[model samples]
Target: MNIFDRSKHIYLSPDFEEIIKDTIRFFNGTPVHSISIAERFHGTGVYAIYSIAKTGIYSKFHLVNRTAFHIPIYIGKAVPKGWRQARQGLSENTRSYELNNRIREHSRSINLGEGLDIGDFFCRFMILEGKEGDLIGTVEAALIRKYQPIWNTLIDGFGNHDPGKGRYEQAKSDWDVCHPGRSWADKCQGVPANQEVLLQSIENFMAGLNSEEDA
Candidate 1:
């Protein structure tokens, strides 16, 4: 007879794993919509932004999403205000429109980009209200892991908000460097990253994605 102690290892129960898988499937099954239309809805949950632009730097993403949105440029979540403070009950009535506002905000950011267009970006979102809202972060993280979106993994800071008054001394984000047009980002006292280096990083990331597909 062989004896093994299950307590020695940490793992999610099969049921929990299945729940995650189901959530991912639910998210993927959601309708793909334009970022321009995001302001028409309200809720809190996870979303994926896809780019089908033919920009030279983003040609790989364009190619992948041209026929089908198999790649996401970014994945993110919007959670109810105060949910993090264990005051979820209060959040229920707040009607903050977190998800809608977040997606709209992304549209504004893209509109401000030097060479980006809102029409070239599309999104798929799942609005997990009430108890399901708790899964927002988990679903976003899982999708990001599965897709390795460039905005989430490589070119960071696409989700950043204004640093407010005293935080102007912070360095500009890589996203700001690559797509600079946000007025507030200009006030950041630190120098932006080198464009060439950021482009190289993007190329390397695309190469890895290609290698994975070939495998």
Candidate 2:
């Protein structure tokens, strides 16, 4: 059964999220609990909300959470069926997480020496010393263009996520499946109109940054 068909709804997109790969592993630095939660629990019950299962037979069943990370990462949620179909709809050139170890590997940037913050999580996280955004954005826009129609159908079907109130109850089939690849947008599907949504996602993520400025 589709996981979203149940009472669970992800507060944040788990389809594609940037996490300190080390956070989920015994990287000889991070904590065991953090890695355990990331692996066993699937993700921090916090920002990058996800659905998890203990075993294969009863898989679809997952617990919803929001505060599951000590690192800041962005979650990419494509149209609804995005996770359902996997990379089958993408181009043959479409990157596959299953093909390489990097796809499922861990990442680390800043050590959350303190704990976790929601607004902090929303803030923009760039890489390659700022160049990461350019490379990432370009790729995202391309995919959005190729999958325009299907993308529209999925986002529309997933429905709207309230700015902060919690579950967007209206989504059709929410799941915490891993993203097919990093930067799924690869430039917002190449649609000029779609850029706005991508921007909104950025805006939503940087909510904490906004508050800091206000302070």
> How well is each residue in 152-185 modelled by candidate 2, as lDDT tens digits?
3222312122223333333222111112122222
Candidate 2 residues lying further than 4 Å off, grouped into runs, are: 1-129, 149-159, 165-215
Candidates' TM-scores? 0.89, 0.19
- Model 2 compared with the native: what TM-score? 0.19
For candidate 1, what is the lDDT?
0.85
Model 1, span 1-215: residue lDDT tens = 75888877877577877898999888888899999882477688999999888775676676677766778899999988777886764444556678898999999999998768788999999999867877888888889989889999889999999999999999899999988999999999987789889979988887666522443
Clashes of each: 0, 25
Top candidate on TM-score is: 1
Q: Which ten contiguous residues of candidate 1 have the minimum total lDDT? A: 206-215
